[model samples]
Target chain A: MRRQNLALVMTTVAAHGPLSRAAIAGRTGLTRAAVSSLVEELNTAGLLTELGSLPSGRAGRPGRALALSERGPAGLGLEVGVGHLGACVVDLRGEVRGWLRVAADNRNRPADEVLAELATVSRRAVTEAEGTGLRPVAAVLAVPGLVGEAPGTVATAPNLGWRDVAASGLCAQGLPLEVENEANLGALAELWHGTGTSDFIHVSAAEGIGAALVVGGRLFRGARGFAGELGHVPLCPDGPVCACGARGCLEQYAGEEAVLRQAGLAAGEDAVRRLASRAREGDRCALAALERAGEALGTALAGAVNLVDPEAVVLGGAYAELGDWLLPGMRRELTARALRRWPPKALLVSGLGRRGPLLGAGMAAIRRIIEDPAELTVSRSRR
Target chain B: MRRQNLALVMTTVAAHGPLSRAAIAGRTGLTRAAVSSLVEELNTAGLLTELGSLPSGRAGRPGRALALSERGPAGLGLEVGVGHLGACVVDLRGEVRGWLRVAADNRNRPADEVLAELATVSRRAVTEAEGTGLRPVAAVLAVPGLVGEAPGTVATAPNLGWRDVAASGLCAQGLPLEVENEANLGALAELWHGTGTSDFIHVSAAEGIGAALVVGGRLFRGARGFAGELGHVPLCPDGPVCACGARGCLEQYAGEEAVLRQAGLAAGEDAVRRLASRAREGDRCALAALERAGEALGTALAGAVNLVDPEAVVLGGAYAELGDWLLPGMRRELTARALRRWPPKALLVSGLGRRGPLLGAGMAAIRRIIEDPAELTVSRSRR
Candidate 1:
């Protein structure tokens, strides 16, 4: 019972905090005395701090405000993308304290080698956070593949030539670790930081297209954790075959490689950037290729919308960089094909871009501490 | 608190009865005395009955078993199909007491005229149920289109030429009425009475194809209650124009009319039955047409499965009658196109066939009384 009350207080403050004890009690339906007791424990653990007093509304002495502490246990986030590696730290306030990114060709490389490099990057990020008085408590790593139900196991990352690899124990050595799918993390980021809708589809792209569904404020993983494989939804039943042995999947038209190939550009680390620039400069081939890709994306999304009926569709990852060129064709197809009256405001471009997965990883770790502060508090008392 | 306990006892008995009072207390985490009190009230209200005593394993006397009363208030179900109108009464134990079906060409007919005829049928069903010692308390009408968020207004039924029609007040006089979409009700019936999987997709077809998603035992109504218009999902994006003004929708290839046309048969009330008999007799044209329709249905379902990842797909309504002819092409396309490994057991045919919608409607109304017997008890006490 105490643990549940503690969580209620902590989450209330995290969501609508910098509040007085009376305000916290009012919002959470707890008595003022109970709020004060929880606040004291949180303050002692460095999970909360007192701020300036609020002006009295009731002609009495003013009450001091309380907020989530900035110097508390923080989260360390790491990412293993196909083309890059990243690490960062986020505080309870959902603010990044340190960030690092490095270009690397991780595809098909030995898993140990890539994780070893990530550990080094994570150590640097932890040290950077420590310099600011933030204690790094836990870590989460996001990867572009299917994650097993068991924590820290990557069932299959086809692009990385990995199958059934254990990932958590090798990185962020001292902290407890969890692994998550990059697309799921990206959708969580959109829910917690971007559009803030409890129900939406987050579509992202890098080496291949991926999507994650958010339903009622939680990720909607299917029965086997294989929902949201939007990339493989057939666009044409008899068109050219795909690597997954499907014919004319949406990925064959809208994935990063597909767009570049259609634009007659060589595949490289900077190819998407070049294509974006070319389209911006009124190059006919680049413009046409992006428009067609957008149409194909819309066609697939129309099917998704007809089936799932999410409140919004967010364009994230590489797609965010090409939103202006993509939205027109997408809107046209959705308007014409979607069974529901397509709302113009339902399509949104993610502001987090390539940073969403790493940031979401950090936020996810921090969220655990906020939800169950008793774990940290119990350990602290033991120490 | 008393009302809640009463409902808990009723639903517990409905699900796992005929159980003893000791068993109810064990399953509900309530004291035996509390269970006895709730059961007394339920029995007094004619909502539960004491059955034969269970065989005792202990040294003490055996306890009488409890079950939902068959003589209590019942539900009236009504359906407005393009080619038929139906009415039935179901008792608290989910047994149908009375049923009536009449062929009616309701297409583009005046709403009042069709509803007036339906009221006559519902009256007969209610009278028949009452003769069997059951009182019909509520009714639910199932329609083949979008129902508004408001209780009884239908937003649209394109085939019925209905838009913004207030339906609840028009039919089943003197009984409280509710409105629901036929596809949604079919999925609910599958959950409560058929496959019983908490997560699956129910696909039904008549004039047009419809699909409903069940997530965690509840209907996943999208942002606008328009989530399952599978007929409009593009099958061949550029093949043929549809009445919905979209090109190559699934309806153009797999709907009842479409299959009849492909088989060189005339469109009429008995068209689907004729097609089925022909396919059974090894007629090439009917067999070929059914195969093609199955492929189109599979193509659309593969996209749905890729996006939602349901545990199973149930073929319902008219499609269930033709399952033997449809399963082959469906399995082939799903194996070829769906990203996840396809399991043959995931495809099922509804044994309820065309009766799912009406049964589901009656079950829904009965569920409301089962969930909250307080309303009935309180009214009875007043009398």
Candidate 2:
């Protein structure tokens, strides 16, 4: 009970930022006494600190402002995307301390080569963060593919043309790594940091359209850790064949390659930016392509909405940058397809931008420590 | 802790009935002594009964057979379908004591008239069960409609031509009844009584295609109560218009009326049975209609499967009755559309037949009592 209270208090402060004990008690439904004790325990453990005093807003003396400490346990996050490999380290306060990203067409690259390069980058991130005396508590890798239920295996990465790759120990040292899909991590970033809304769908459109579900503030990884395969969800049924041997999938219409092709731009790193610029300049073809892509995405998402009935559909990745051009068509189909009267603002663009996955991976690692602070202390003793 | 343990023991027995204390302990990971104590408490509370002794195959001593009691704390269930109104009462042991169903075309009928008639039937069923000396613990109404997030309102029932109807108090007397969608109840029933699998989609097709999701043995109600609107999931975006104002919805291709019309049969209650017999007799038109309907249903379900990633798809209601004709097509599309290597036997037919909803509704009510037996005992003392 005490452990749970401590974790709850830490996460509450982490998510909501600096809060008075009374505010935390109100937020967590814990008594003020319990919150105070938990806050004191966390402070003693170096996971939290008091930021002098802040006005209570109520007619009373100022309350102590509690915040996550910059010292102690930190999280190391690594990502292997279709076109980039990135790494970052986040402190207990959820602030990024060190970060690195290298753009490379990873689709045709050998898995070992890319992972090894990623490992070097991840080591540098860890060492760089360590320079500030931060100890690594957890390490997580985000890959753009379907992760198997069992540990250490990337089942398939259609865009990367890789399957059954063992992905557990990509770092310089064996750090009990957790491998999750990039989109899932991105959604987690939004869930823990951006909106903090419990039930939403984060749809990330890149080379592929990947969606992740957040139900009750937790990433809803389904039966085999394959819950959110929105890209392959059939839209037109007979429209076009996909790499997964399926036809009329959402990716065929709204994915980066498809949208780029429709816009008469070569599918490359800057295609989305170019499409956005072209559309901004009132280019009819670019506008038409984006509109068509948005319509297709919205049509498929409408079906998804009818089935899942989420609070909101958060557009992420390249879609986040292009949501302004896409949302009009997307909202039309979603409104037409919804069985319930949607709230005036049901579709939202992710505020995390493209850095969401790396940040989420870091948060996920930090969350593991928060969920079990005893593990953090034990690791600290070992270090 | 004791209360949670008691509920766990009861639910374990309820899900996998007729277990010895040792078996229950093993299944629940509770110590034999703890199980024995919990069993004694439940038996003393009249919630459980021991049936002498049953021989243990590999054990030295014969273990006493423990089961849920067959008396007290009965659940009252009422269902409003597009073509039928039904009521049932089930006891502590999940045994039905009374059931009644009246077929009526409810689409054109006024909400008050239909609900009033339903109330009459429910009162009679409750009175009939009372004669057997069973006390009502909880009452649940299962409506074939989109129930809103806030309780007691049917947002829409496109098939029944109803919308925005306040449906909280339905029976003659004021019973603070809980209203749930029929499909959600059906899924709960399967989750509790069928295979007891944690994650699966229950697809019940009759006048419309209704689906419910069960994750970790609990109903996955989405952001709102309007989750699992499988009927409205667009399959062929431009195929045909749906009653929900969407084009090419699953209902247009696989709904009862659509299938019957395609089979050259007048759409009515008997059409499903007639189609089944005709298909059994090698009638090409009927076979073609069923095949098309199954394929369309599968195509949409495939998209659903891709998004939700359930362990299995359990066909219920009319679909179960017509599984032989539907399985091949449904399986083909589902298997073809899956991103993962799905288990060979991922499709299942409900064994409870059409009795699933009534059973589920009753079980749901009983579950409320089981969750808080203190309430049941308190109500009993008051009575």
TM-score of chain A of each: 0.95, 0.86
Q: What digit string (tens of lDDT, one per residue) describes model 1 on residues A279-367?
A: 99999999999999999998888888888888889999878899999989888888898888888899889999878999999999899
> Candidate 1 docking: what grade?
medium
> Cα miss at B382, model 1 (Å)?
5.9
Q: Kindly list the per-residue Cα lDDT of model 2 for residues B61-85, writing each as its tens digit.
A: 8888998887655788888887788
The ten-residue window of minimal lDDT in model 1 chain A covers: A168-177
Q: Which pairs clash inside model 2?
A: none
lDDT of each: 0.87, 0.83
Error at A274, model 2, angstroms? 1.4
Q: Please report the candidate that would top DockQ against the real structure.
A: 1
Listed models, DockQ each: 0.73, 0.70
Provide the TM-score of chain B versus the true chain B for each model in turn.
0.94, 0.83
Residues B1-383 of candidate 1 have per-residue lDDT tens digits of: 88888889889998999999999999999999999988888888888999998985777999999999899689888999898888899999999899998889899999888888888888888889889999887788989888877787788898899988887765545567889999888888888889768888899987888789998898888866778888888887787998788888899999988999999998766688899999999999999999999999988889888888999889998789999999999988888888898889998999888889998899998998899888778655876
Q: Where does candidate 1 stray beyond 4 Å?
A: A20-41, A52-64, A379-383, B1-5, B19-41, B52-64, B170-173, B379-383
